[model samples]
Target: MSPSIEKNNNNNSSIARESITEQVTINEKLNLCFPLESLTQVRSDLINYSKINDKKLDQGLLSQLMIDDNLLCRYMKRRRGHIEPSVQFIIGALEWRHSLGLDKCSEETFPVELFSSGGLFILGHDNTGNTVLHIRVSHFYKIPELIGLVKQFVMFHMYKADEMGSRSFPLTGGWVLVFDCSNASLAQGDPEMLAFINSSLKNYFPAGQKYILIINLNWVLRAIKTLAFTWYPSAVKNRIKFISIKQVTDYIPLNELPDYLGGSVNCYRSIPKNCTTLETLRSNGSITLAQSAYDKIIKILTLVN
Candidate 1:
């Protein structure tokens, strides 16, 4: 063979070796994080489901789902012996989300006042190092807005959690919620809203939550809790705790919490009028993923369903 022909053959061989090495590395990582048999079973189930639904699994989508770090973390950290079901659910949910084009939904469509007025704030971490999500329940009048706000907050932390995992700290892997109801009224404590909130905390958030601290708890909230827990899952009920403002430091460090919540820190700075969209949060480093990343995650998830 001529010299150029030999050189071309060498390049092709090198590329083939690299591809095989990459595949092996991925498989090894997957095996380390999940039982290979369980992973294979879940994939087989997905393939069967697609056939029954008259849908074909795109190789590119499957590849993306397999290599996604967030999905890997979610599966690996699922409750012991539940990894298979978690994989199935994550894949199926992604497929459905993709089919509905829910990935295209933008934060601009949400009410700007949700963030501008401090309805939801990612107020750093708690004493236990769990990410603190502060929700001003009084600001929300409608259930839909409340739901949207919580989803957005969760999405923001999901990305942050992924970044933290890369750094080996995983700060957003666990959460400690502070439901500041200091100014909340009885009317705002709607049963439907409470149910929705409970469902989101239980079903949506990856890695689950550590604690849900309801500040300024009163007789009205006490009454609402009775109705809310009737429908709330028992596992999450153990994590929920009501505390007076003075008792905040007992659960969270004073330096990490907000001044309004009886902590020394004042993290809730005013949102500038121009910073009305989710992009503003991204720019401030308060949010990790861009709109495209969010859409990509939804598309990946929707492929299996």
Candidate 2:
């Protein structure tokens, strides 16, 4: 109860308060870097939810989930409340794929020859610097294969988005999908294909598809659009444009597209044999760079916890 003892107790109380204040300040900074609703925690909750539903998570899948979270967080940081619903929808699609025991489609397993020969290729960037994914819908017969090819292209766009640091807003500096349905037939409209396309546009493409220009839209495409619109959210539906073959130049310059699509460029070539494998894509420098950043963010989260 002496003056010295009382002073010592007061000093200890002051130090404790300072420590708590410092901790709160650190957390506020972290929340700026990483929102309070951490994507890592969301991923964990998803994994646990999957397990309860009799789905097992393997290391490879877990690694992918991490990458996905990283990609989502990168964009979500900028958009935050505006895009969280879309981000969550994407996570749900991933979870559904995992639950169905569907392995992530690899570049090797993808029908590269079919895509190359059939006229689906990256036709360089559009006028606005968005990567153009040129697809010849006529060449596709098998719906699942088409879905797989599209999925690979989606990943390709994500890779480019990461490289460009297109994190400020969803679909900013992303992909412009040009679907040339010149020879597309009504017979190609399988329910499963429609479902997959709907899912991709709604759940996956929202983050990367800056503009979806369906050119050479015949009756078949018009019919498909009717069906797809029923499932597409309003934001996604707004990005889609049913255009004439000649109208594509409004979005993509003639020099950027392939020769067949009114451009002088010869863009169709075999997928590099070495780069055809999923391993190669996974080891891409851009992806590695993004993953490094992701790892650091995760480390911070770990320390905070």
Candidate 3:
């Protein structure tokens, strides 16, 4: 049977969700849509596997895994609906998170300069309601020594994005990563840090990346992309698009973007002075640091109007 690809009108990304009889495949937008039979069977297999391998599983991982259909589907899809390998992938991800203490990671885990640098933050939401993560590649060059810290910081955002996904209306639970490479040169690409980042995005964030927009293309950025593309897996590579800064308005509105990116909002002054720890934020259900900063900018804009 021919696949019936349906556009999800509610999303700004115009992601197409395809349904075919007995089988479905990844869409043009690289959306993770499979037939219900494969999804259901993989889910059941995981649950059954968990029962038999309880001793091998993390204490609460099974319960958490069972409840999140999206998470299960993501891993299953990543492994192409193979039950055993999918379970292994999920288990490996859980182990990596535990080893890294990702759940306990917080603002204090790294230097204050990391957050205040304005290199990485949550700017606003795109048209699809997915959170927009702005990463200033130029800023990263200034602190090459802090590569490990930088890795943790990026992962922390991924953790929060997942948290946000669980609570948000759309349930998309991932980030629209906007890597602003303006003024950044090829010299800024630290191989160690780049390798770490590449591994994390591929292994850790299961179906978590909504889109990766590389804006302000220059020769330097072009060189970096040439190298980086080789490092990305087919799944990760598919979601990336090289767009000019002006074209960013297609996925994200002009009003939500900062002036640097051809948006009206000036979020420079809106960076949060302090942030709640990841654990505290998780427990209290508070807004994210990035969201808080964007909110501050919006509030000021509203007041002036």
Best by lDDT: 3
Over 1-305, each residue of candidate 3 has an lDDT whose tens digit, in order, gives 23333333434243333233213443323344545555566667766766776555554545666666656666666677676777677777766766666645666555444565577777778887777878777766523333444577788876666556545532245567888878777656556666676787777666656888888878855766688789877967888888888788889998889888888876543334465333354245432445555455345334322
lDDT of each: 0.58, 0.57, 0.64
| lDDT of candidate 2 over 21-134, digit per residue (tens) | 776786566533344346556566555655665344323544554565445554443345344453465455555545433444444544333445544566577777776677
Indicate the residue-level lDDT of 173 in model 1. Answer: 52
Please give the distance, in angstroms, between residue 180's alpha carbon in candidate 2 and its true position after superposition.
0.6
Give stretches of model 1 more than 4 Å off: 1-33, 40-65, 76-79, 82-84, 95-102, 105-111, 143-172, 267-305
Q: How well does model 2 score by local distance difference test? A: 0.57
* Candidate 1, RMSD to the unseen true structure: 14.1
Question: Candidate 1, residues 38-127: lDDT per residue as tens digits?
Answer: 556655665566666534333344554465544444543654436566656555545544443334434443334444556666766766
Output the TM-score of candidate 3: 0.66
Model 2: runs farther than 4 Å from truth?
1-70, 74-91, 99-104, 142-173, 189-191, 204-206, 274-305
Which is the winner by TM-score between candidate 1 and candidate 3?
A: 3
RMSD of each: 14.1, 14.0, 12.8
Cα distance off (Å), candidate 2, residue 191: 4.9
Worst 10 residues of 1 by lDDT: 296-305
Model 3 poorest ten-residue lDDT run:
21-30
